[model samples]
Every structure is written in C-alpha cells, then in structure tokens.
Target: MTKPESAEQDHGYDVVISGASLAGSAAAILLARRGVRVALLERRSDPDAYKVLCTHSITANAYPVLDELGLIPAVEKTGAPHNDARWHTRWGWIEPKAAPRGPELPHAYNIRRSTLDPMIRSLAARTPGVDLLLGHQVTGLVREAGRTVGVRASAPQGEREIRAGLVVGADGKDSAVAKYAGVPTQRHENTRFGYLAHFRNLPLDGGIGQTWFLEPDMAYAFPNDDGVTVLAVLPDKKHLPAFREDLEGSFLSFIRALPEAPPIDGAERISKIIGTVDYPLISREPTAPGVALIGDAALTSDPLWGVGCGWALQSAQWLAEAVAPAATGRGDLDRSLALYARTHRRRLRGHQFLAVDYAKARPFNPGERLMFSAAARDASMARHMHLFASRLIGPMRFLSPVALAKATAVNIRHRGTAASARPRTHSEP
Candidate 1:
C-alpha cells in the first residue's frame, strides 16, 4: 500500500482515482500501462476489502477487458466458468437444450468478491507509476475555477490534499466523489430488497445458472467454485417484515417455495444471509469537466441480470482508453472526456433503460414475451437470446423488427399447436 506523503512533498501524478475497487484498480492498471502516474485511494484499511453485498458474476462481455488487463488467469483461478442458464417460470423449466457450443469469446465467471478484490488490488499496487493508497477516506473533491483538480482525503497519518490532472470516481453507487462533484443522480425506488448467501453441499449442476421467476418474487442460484452456490431472493416490499424478523428462515422459505428450484432444504450454509434493501439506482450522467464517474458511481442496473461487475470493469476500461492519451499529453483533455461521455451513453443507455423498466416489476412486455417464448421453444432462438443476454449482441439486434416478427410467429404457432393437441369432449349423451 502507498503511504500518504505530506502535502508539501512533490507527489505529482497525472490522475487520482477514488474508490480502489474493481473500477479504480482497473483504471490504474490501464493508465499505468500508458505511462501515466496514478494515485489510487481506498477508504478501507484492509487491502483485501471486497464488496460483501454483491453478486460478483462477471458476464461474457467483460472478459476481453479482463484479458487486456492481464487478469484472466488470476480470475480463472478463483472462478468457475458459467455458460448455460435455466429459467423456472409457471410454464416450467426453460433450460437450454444443449450447452451453447460456438466460438466462445468469453463466458461468464462465477466468482466471490472476497477473492477478487484483493487480487486486483495487489495487481494495481505492483503496476509501475501507480500509487495504491489504502485507509485513505476522501473528504471531498478539489476544484479550481469549476474544474476538478484533485481530492482531499483523511488518512491515519493525517489530513492531506493530493493534486492531479484528472479525477476519476470509481466509487460504488453511493459515491462521495459524485456527490462532492455536484453530479446529479436519478434514483427509482423499486420497493424490493435482495437477500443473498452462499451454501455448500448443494446438489447444483455445474456450467449453468438458475433463475426462478415466481411472478412478483424471484430467486436465483449460481454455481461457484469449491462446490459453493450463491443464492439470492428478490422479494416484494410487502414481505419485508417477515425477512426482518428472521433473515435466514425467510430467505430459505422464499427459495424453497419457488417451483422447481433445487432442494436447498438440506444444504449446509457457508455464510450468513445478507440483505440489501436498495438494489437499484441509475445515474443521469457519468462524466463532467475534468472528472469522470465509472462503475456503480456512474450508473447502477438492477442485479436481476447480474451485470454490475461486468459494467464496472467495462466502464473503467472505456474511461481509461478515452483519457489515457490526454493524460499523457498526446491529446486535448476536454475533447477526450467529452468523447468518453458520449461513448458511455452510446454503449449503456439502451441496456440501462431496459433494466430500469424491468425493475418496475411489470410483466414481460409484448416484445419480451415474444422473445422469451421463442427462446423457450426453439434452440436457435435460445442461442440468439443467450448471446443478447450475455451482452455479446447489442440490444438493437434482439429488438429489430424482423427478429420481433419471427419471435411472435414462433410463439403463436407454438400455442396454436398445443391448443389443437388437446382432447375434445363429447356434446351428446
């Protein structure tokens, strides 16, 4: 860990990043690769600080960035590869007919944050020109003439101000950097909470993730390494009292009540049930003059899709690529930051919109019903749906008029055939 030098000391750096988690650490590594000096500040004293209330599932889309950062092997050691998904609804189990066999760009990884955060932190500390500062709590942003210049932080040694060319907010959803930078955020209350825990000795099939859609309530289980399974239940707000009374019992009951969910009744618990009442929040803008926001600090999506970690890593990579040249004095900083803002919106707006709408607890819209039903009936449709869900394909590909029409036709034909196959009753006696 980097020690906090006195304010008078010459500790010049090109960038100062707050919140030394996934986004912050990734940004530091990327910038350092470009030969830019970076100061990475973390509030937690423990260098191994990980987000306890996270799903910690990295999607297929995030693998390229991890590979680029040379973290694939490290993460693979701690994670299990996840590909297939099983959705249990009133209609029955909608599992992929076969494993998605194709040119695997990067499948998802089921990892626990406890193992991931420390690994990335160590990597950042070893990267040249990167200063990893643990146990430093940022008090506020330093602005000069309306431009973010650096950050004011309090460490065990004492209070200090660190100046830099640019400031990056990689903090989580409730980011102090965003607040002090005066960036406004838009939050939608879904009136739901999530209870999550890990279990051992569970008979969970590897290579697949499971999601039980119990209409207003939902439960999902992901098989992780070391014969552990991560299970979560998203319940409506009306059931808060039951959960508040006995967290473990209520969570277990919720999972057991789900139709076709694996029998977790006999499974041994590996961790205590933890609950997060506020799980959904979306920010309006991710960047400003001289400062940029990454990860949950910029925008938050519902955990139902398990894209938080992927988005965090992706956002960090995007910001680093956008700002590296400028930080190294090869381009205009304002132009670089502006381009980053636009690119961020272009990449995430559609997905975030869909996630926010779904977080409302509304039933699948006509388009969604068509797609899901088609995927349920046709293996080809399932592959396409899987690609889209994994973020390999853009949303436009799934929402195209041709794709929607085909899905609608398939769903209608399936229902029609089922109706025709039913037995008829006699009219006369």
Candidate 2:
C-alpha cells in the first residue's frame, strides 16, 4: 500500500471512523479502496490489539463479502475450523444430512477473536488510503448545526481534532461515540448470563458447531482454530447460583444434562472460565447527521445466535456501498445515510425482533416449537432452518404462510403416529 499524504488538520479525510473493530476496519478498507481517504482510530496503541475472549464465529452467508475483501484465502490459510452447525431442537437434533447444495452453502469459520480482530485490523491498516491511528481515543463529537462533523480524540501526544464528511461509531454495544453524539437507541435487558471457556480435543464434536436450544438454558460448542473449541452456557438469571458456586462444575453439569451432549466430559481446559452477565440488547438509529454507526454500535441482540461477526462485516459493506458515491462527492451524504439506515433496518429488523423476544428467557412459543419440531423431523424443513441459522434468511421469510401450513401438517402427522403407537388398554370387569 502506498503512503497517503496527510491532509489538513481540519476536515482531514473523507471519513473518520471511531473504532477499529471488524465494522470499522471493513469500512475503512472499502472506502479507501475507492479513493476515499479515511482516518481509522483505535483506542489501543498496539496494531495487534484484538477483541479478546468473545464471540468470533462468522457464518457462511458473509463469505461473499469476505471473498470480495480478498480475505477468504488469508482466513482459510489460518486453518480455522470449517464447521457445520447442528441445532438441538425439542424433538431432536436438527442436523442437515445432505451435502451443501451449492457454493452459497459455505462452511462458516470458527476462529478466536484474538486472531480475527488483529487480522482484519491489519488488513485495513495495509490498505492504501487508510490512516490507521492507533491509541486515539474519541473524547467528544464535533457537531455543526446539530450534525456530527468530526471527532476530538485524545492520544499519547495530547489531543487532536480530525474532521470528515462522515464519522462512524463502530465501537461496541456501549458506544462512546454514539453516547457522545446522543444517538437515541432502544435498549432491551438481557435475562440471561453467559459463560464460556476454551477446551481442546473434544472428539465427539470435532470440527462441528453444536448449539442446544434448551429453553431457559442454552449451550454452544464452537469448534475453533488450533484444535480448540469454545464452550458457552447461557442460563437464565434464576440459574446464576450454579455458576457462582462452582463455575467448572456447573458448566460441565449443564453440558452433561444436554440431551445430545458431546463427549466433552473430560476435555482439557485451555482457558479460564470467563463470563458476561449484563450484556444488553441495543438498537440505535444507524445514522445521526454526518455520523453513522455500524455493527454493535447500531444493533446488538442475543449473542446466542452468533450473528455479530456477520452483521459487523455486512453492515460495513452496506454502509460503504451506500456511501461510496457520497464520499466521492457524487451523491448527497444525508440521502446516502438514509439509504444505509433503511437497508440496515430492512435486512436486520426481523432477526432482531425474534432475538429480542428470545432474550427474555421465555419458553418457546407455539410457532417456534412447530418450526423446531418440523425441522427436526423433516429434512426439507431442516434445510430452511439451517439457512436461517446461517444468516441466509430472515425470521419473517422463514416463517411464511406455506411454512406454517407445512409445520401444522407435520405436527398433525406426528400426533397421529403417537396415537397409533399407544398400546390398546383393556378394562377388566
């Protein structure tokens, strides 16, 4: 990548991005590739700084974007597990026995955040026109006429003001940039606490992602890189004591209690049991004036689905594609922001709605039970369920009128079979 000449301290670049996570870095690379000078800021000074010990699964739905970014080869080169998913539904394990139908049915990547974050950040830094500003912490928004115009950041050498046509909050759920800009957001409480640790050598679940939807308690085993698997258990608030009293014991017991528990009973632990209890479901307006938000800064619901990584990259792609013309001075910035927001809502709202509803720790509703059971019993139904989980389709589309009709028929047939299977009872006189 060629070195970029520094622009004036005032209005320095085409875009000023707040965080250097997936969304931020992705936006930087995409924009800079189109001759948009970008200032990508990271609070941590180290170029290798990565999101630690958190979710790092990116579904196959985002593979096209990854390929577009020229990241697929590098990511594959890392030897990250190419994992298939199996969902434990009420009826049974809903596993797709058929091979992937096409190139679209790609295997998802399960790499550690420690590796992924740095890799992506490095990719952005190496882009031609991106000024990767490490250790720059955004202190306040620079607003003009009630519109975000720039950001005031604090760095090792004191403070500096950088301006741009757009400022993006790619920061995490508790977004400092969004907060400083006073972006209005709808917040939902998470009724469950999550705990996890990395284990090595679980032969039964080798290179396969297994998620159990046990109502009120959920478990995930993500086969990750370097022969490691990250095991997570999310339990309702009422079940917090089991984790508090004995972390390992409770985690193991919960896994053992799972109907389709893997032979991870004696897997070797490779990391400490870390957890998060106060993770919230947040949804904010995606744009504010000259500022736009992406990834968790815009929306973060239940982590149980592992959609965060995909959304981060996806929303960045949406924003960059929508705003590229604006960055190049060909389109209206506000209109572009509006388009991005509309696209974001249209693409994500259905999934967010269902995720928020499930985050409340409630039992599965009739529709959910119907879908899960049908998906378990029928291969055709399982394919749709698999697609939905892979982020290839949204909830509303997955549960169409035809789907409901099929689910009803499946349930009726199962009921009939059960009734027939019941033995005849003879009453003695």
Candidate 3:
C-alpha cells in the first residue's frame, strides 16, 4: 500500500472512475444525473469502440437500470432487440413460457458491445457533470492520508493527476485501479475456454437465446442485431487441442454436434472468431479506502453464464444508489463507500459461488440433474430457473428447500416410471 501525502491536493471531481466503458460510464451517468462531479477515464481513443471479444448477452436483470438511464429506447433504435432465453438440460430444454419480465425485474438484451458501448459512453459523456477523458490510461492511485483520493493517469497530452472524493475501478478483469488500490481478490481455476463467432443470415427464432449444457461442453446461440446470430461454445481444455488445430472448422463441428444444433448451415461468418482461454473466475472485495470496484473489476465469473454485461450495469446501479447521498455531500462519504461495499458483496457472493463451481467444467451432479429434470417437467420450476439465470432472483429464492424437495420428488418419480417400463428377465426369479 503506497500511501503518500501530496503537497497540493487537487480535488477535481466528486468521483474519478477508471474505464469509461460499461460500469464506469453507467456510474458516471448516475452520479452526473444527480449533479455530482464525475471524471470518466478511458484508454480507448475511438468514440465508437466496443469490447470485441464478448458475446454481449445483457441479462434481463439490467433492463431496469437501462430504463433508468433512458438508454433502452436508444438501444432499441440501434436495432438491438429484447431476447427470450431457454436452457437445455439433460432431461430436455428448460424453456419458460412466461412473458418477458416487467420493469421491476431483469430482462434480456441482445446487442453487441460495439453498439452498446458507444451508446453508454455517449450518455455518460453528455451528462452535465461528467467529464469524459478518453485516451486516458490509469497508472497509479492518488493517495492522501492513507486513503485513495483519485488517480494518476497518462493521456495523449501528458501524465497528470485527477483528484476526487472517491475513485472507482470499472476497468474489467485485470483492473489497474484494483491493482493500484491493493484490493484483495480470490481467483478460481477454470477448466473451460470460450469461443464466439457471429454469423449472418442464420436461420433461427428471431429474438430467442438458447443455451445447451452438454456437460463439459456448452453452446449458446442468440439472434442479435442486423440479422446476425452469435454462436458461442465453452468447451473444456481437454478439447482445445482439436479446436486449435482448426479454429473455424472445429467451432462449426462442435456446434453442429449438439442434439438440436442451430440452423446455421450456409451462414456467412461476419466477424473473426473471437476466443479466450485464460478467463479464471475472479471475485474481489469491491472496495478499498476511497476506491470502489464495479463490473468485472469487482467480480468476474464464468463466461459461459453470459452475466458480465448485465452485472456491470447492475453493479454500477448498486454503487450509485449506495453512494449518491454521500457523493452529493449529504452524508459521510467513507461510510457511504462502506455501504456500497457491503451491498455489492451481499448481492453477488452467492451468484459468484455458483458460477465458480460451474467454471470447474464438471458434469452436473445428482442435485443439479434433479433440478434440471424438474424444470423440464414443471413450468413453474423452469420459470424459477430462468429468473435465477437472468439474475432477476437471487440464489436463496431459486434454491429454497421447497424447490429442492420438489425437484427431488420429480426426479424420483421419473426414475420409477423409467424402471417400470424396463423389460424383466425370468432367469433372475
């Protein structure tokens, strides 16, 4: 911890946020809307830039936040559409037939980060109190009296300091602010690597997102903007050798092998195949002194779950709500930061645990099989499962004792029915 006292403390903004992408921009928008000063720093120079290596499936849980930001209509205007999600389990596809979640709950958004990022940055940069400092790379934390006051950033002009009451790290998984703040993180080993490619003219349900959990291998297909469908696969490392041999060939082969494979025959690859193998599940305590972390900076889970974009927006909302009064000078800022930290942990701990558990790339256990089977049999179970996956409901609600018992009984009944149908040999008698 490098705590140094500065001779001339420069308090420029209420909050200096690193990374002007999803989380940082969203936080800036929130605070700026409330007339709190914000400095949004981004390393990228391009105003239209987006995160290229992402599947970009925004979960339903972030819909409310989008609405609050007044950006949902903008996203829709950009051809990004609402999505209905279905999960493929061992028994069958756990497809919920319910209408899309209301404004109070999370809902799905199928938009590329290319469109989403610029839209988000535009909103933040245009906010009255936000200063969008593009092409700025955060180098170190500005410390005063043993608390992080802001950041030392290098921009196109030169290196300079930006001071604030609080500094936020929304800088993705390998967060420089988190590193500078000496924030503690727990890394979990991930057994699977992810690959995603966009295809044009793919024949599929227009606004439906589908995921197949074939044990150690999982694949998802979502129809996104501009008549393109994104197909992604998470295969265990054991299968990487074959994929490395032929990137495009192997990706197509793997997806084609799924039980009810996507109808992508004769589809054109619109983008280069994007992939990542080093995505370890990362969970960090989201605050340090005067600094707070949001998005992947705070907690990065399995990519197979497609929760990053949603979590980024949702966490930003949580932080903004938690610290608004303090940042506006109505309450103690440190106590407000602590409040944000506690709220972040409470909201994400259970989700992170389950995501990390699945990141091990292991096949479903008996309990999981029971739940999946029950979800396949019961619409209510399927709806609950979908709500949990979308992050509209927490783990405690999704994994209650009643749900577990129902799943167990459903599985037992399925077993009994199968056993009754089996032919018996007289030799045993």
Reference-based lDDT, each prediction: 0.81, 0.84, 0.83
Q: After superposition, how far is residue 138 of candidate 2 from its true place, in Å?
A: 0.2
Displacement of residue 367 (Cα, Å) in model 2 is 0.3
TM-score of 1: 0.94
Model 2 residue 61 distance off true place after TM-score fit, in angstroms: 2.4
Stretches of model 1 off by over 4 angstroms after superposition: 4-10, 97-101, 104-106, 423-429
Model 1 root mean square deviation, Cα atoms: 3.4
Could you tell me which 10 consecutive residues in candidate 3 have the lowest summed lDDT? Answer: 1-10
TM-scores, all candidates, are 0.94, 0.94, 0.93
Q: Candidate 2's residue-wise lDDT over 171-232, tens digit each?
A: 98989989998898899989999998888877654357888888878989988887788889
TM-score: which is higher, 1 or 3?
1
Give Cα distance to truth, residue 120, candidate 2, Å.
0.8
What does candidate 1's lDDT look like per residue over 256-331, in tens digits?
7777666798888889888788776677588877799999999888887888898889998998889999987899
- How many residue pairs clash in model 1? 0
* Ordering by lDDT: 2, 3, 1
Model 2 segments more than 4 A misplaced = 1-11, 99-104, 423-429
